[model samples]
Target: MFWSRKEKEHSSKKGEDFSEVIERIKSGDKKLRERFINDYRPFILGCVSKHMNRFIDIENCEEFSIGLMAFDEAISSYNSIKGGHFLSFAELVINRRLINHRKKEIKNSKVIPFSYFGGENEQIIENSISEKSIYLHYDRFEMREEIMIYNEKLEMFGITMNDLVKKSPKHKDSKELMVGIAKIIADNDNLYNKLISKKTLPMSDLIAFVTVNPKTVEKNRKYIIAVCLALKSDLEIIKGFIRKF
Candidate 1:
């Protein structure tokens, strides 16, 4: 059996629009909801593991459960038309859930001692989870500041986070290719400055310089611009996010 050209074209665009998929998932599209979970599972686990400092057992782990719930919350709360990425919002929710859980655990217990360690050491460890929660606030604060800086930087380039979220390349291979294009721009001085100064994709230059399709580059123009700026700027967290998911 063979697929028709129209069928092939329909399949091609089934999941390409990330923002549309997210909105449908929020509107109770069961298939899309499943896709959302499967798609972002690794991302959610990565956030949970980094926050918890270990790989989580999704089968029966509370932290994993919390992370899933937080991700779900992020999905419901995500505004695709707004200027923010879903993963960033999800990470913030995961951190908040973990922090609140630690607070609750600490509050419900009185003189909870760990006999494995001496009394003082156990107390220190127990208190550390609570205290560490406060320090995590600083981490979130730094991310917020970075987001503000990133937003302003993107504005200078005539783009916004909403544009990135909406126009990101559909396939991983396409995204990787775009990342390479971004690297090319980041590695060169003139191209970088031209893009920065003009707030636009140097399409002719990129088409001549980078070995990629002009149509593809233009289709993912906003995302390429954002990635180029992120790679060139001090946006560590955003860079890590792009590299990770």
Candidate 2:
């Protein structure tokens, strides 16, 4: 949504390989390199904004600077023959750098601001956990980062965050039922593998393990897959949230 139609058309022109463009940049084309980065500035900002799940104030945001650096790093490190789109690799790098930045911020935020109370014999803020506000901030950051990763995984299965909101079961009992179904898939190696590889519910196979109506599974397909993916992933924060049900 950030990129313009003209730029979109330009990028989509047949036979244009960005790897070759990177090669040109590496071959000492300073102007081309600058032009490329300029052209992709919107993309860099878009990535940062999407990661933060809010519109970025580019001039004031550290994440935008980090995103640009990550894009440059991706340009330097990408291996086209390794088999993935250049932008996909760039997004991965951007997310990694942003998450790392969040972690460093969390660490820095733990440092006590008051130095007057400290002496060799006096008690300082010995544990950062004393700062409840900072600890909660770090927790929120972790959850946001986890959700970003989950969003990417959902895209792979043709599910969006919006889809989750719309398709989630309304009743508590139905929600519990869905989680139960997801756990069945997550706990079974063969069923989980089938869901991952096929990018869809193995409904027929899933039905064999549950007594739920086939129509219920069909209606809540996206939510079921999402829950199953969360259980399969190392997303402790999301798993914790899911445990409420």
Candidate 3:
């Protein structure tokens, strides 16, 4: 999704380009800069949420503040020739800042203060680096754990990530309807049990319990089951992504 320099220049014709506005901001358009940041607050929050792997409360999140600063820094440092797309660069900066902020927090939580071991400054530096590495490793480990569990669940229904990406409803109304149907099935004990045991959507029971079109249910059976599985599991990050939709 990274925009090339040519794409950034030409996309204005489609009314989806931000390069011009970014250029204006870079040229010291203070008012537009403020408005631009305000308008893109949701994008900033989304990047932070993805890193945190949960829903965020914008009013209280320190990470969100860091994201905003990082985005502002991106606008200041961004180079169309070298940065690809402004947003892509901004997200990279935001994630890097958030990671560094997290590492500092981890370092602060050490059992003894660095000042306590006056001549052991080198040891403290080594421990900090080690902890940062472990933090990153554990973060990847947790995400992998969730993905493995989700993949296993999808396999039970004979669905792949490719299937979901390709078959997921393109229309907003259709997507909402599918999510609603999935929620219903996930909430009902009998329907959920039947789906788990059968390893397929219980269409008849779902239709009987709800007033949805049977053919629609059948058409999106895999997607419906996938959503239901997400709802039934403890995969907070997966659930967070679904909430965005």
TM-score of each: 0.47, 0.52, 0.47
lDDT of 2 by residue, 95-179 (tens): 7788677666657665533321234423445443445564565467666766766786788789999999999999999999999
Model 3, CA-based lDDT: 0.73
lDDT of 1 at 76: 82
**lDDT of each candidate versus the true structure:** 0.70, 0.77, 0.73
On lDDT, the candidate that comes out on top is: 2
Please say which candidate is ahead in lDDT: 2 or 3: 2
Q: Could you say which candidate leads in TM-score?
A: 2
Candidate 1 local lDDT, 133-190, one digit each (tens): 5446546855785786688668866788888878888889888888888888888878
- Which candidate order results from sorting by lDDT in descending order? 2, 3, 1
Considering summed lDDT, which 10 consecutive residues are worst modelled in model 2?
113-122
Stretch of 10 with least lDDT, candidate 3: 111-120
Candidate 2 residue pairs in backbone clash? none
- Candidate 2 off by > 4 Å: 1-130
Tens-place lDDT digits, model 3, residues 114-148:
33223536454643345555576546755665676
Clashing residue pairs in candidate 3 (N, C-alpha, C atoms within 3 angstroms): none
Q: What is the total number of backbone clashes in candidate 3?
A: 0
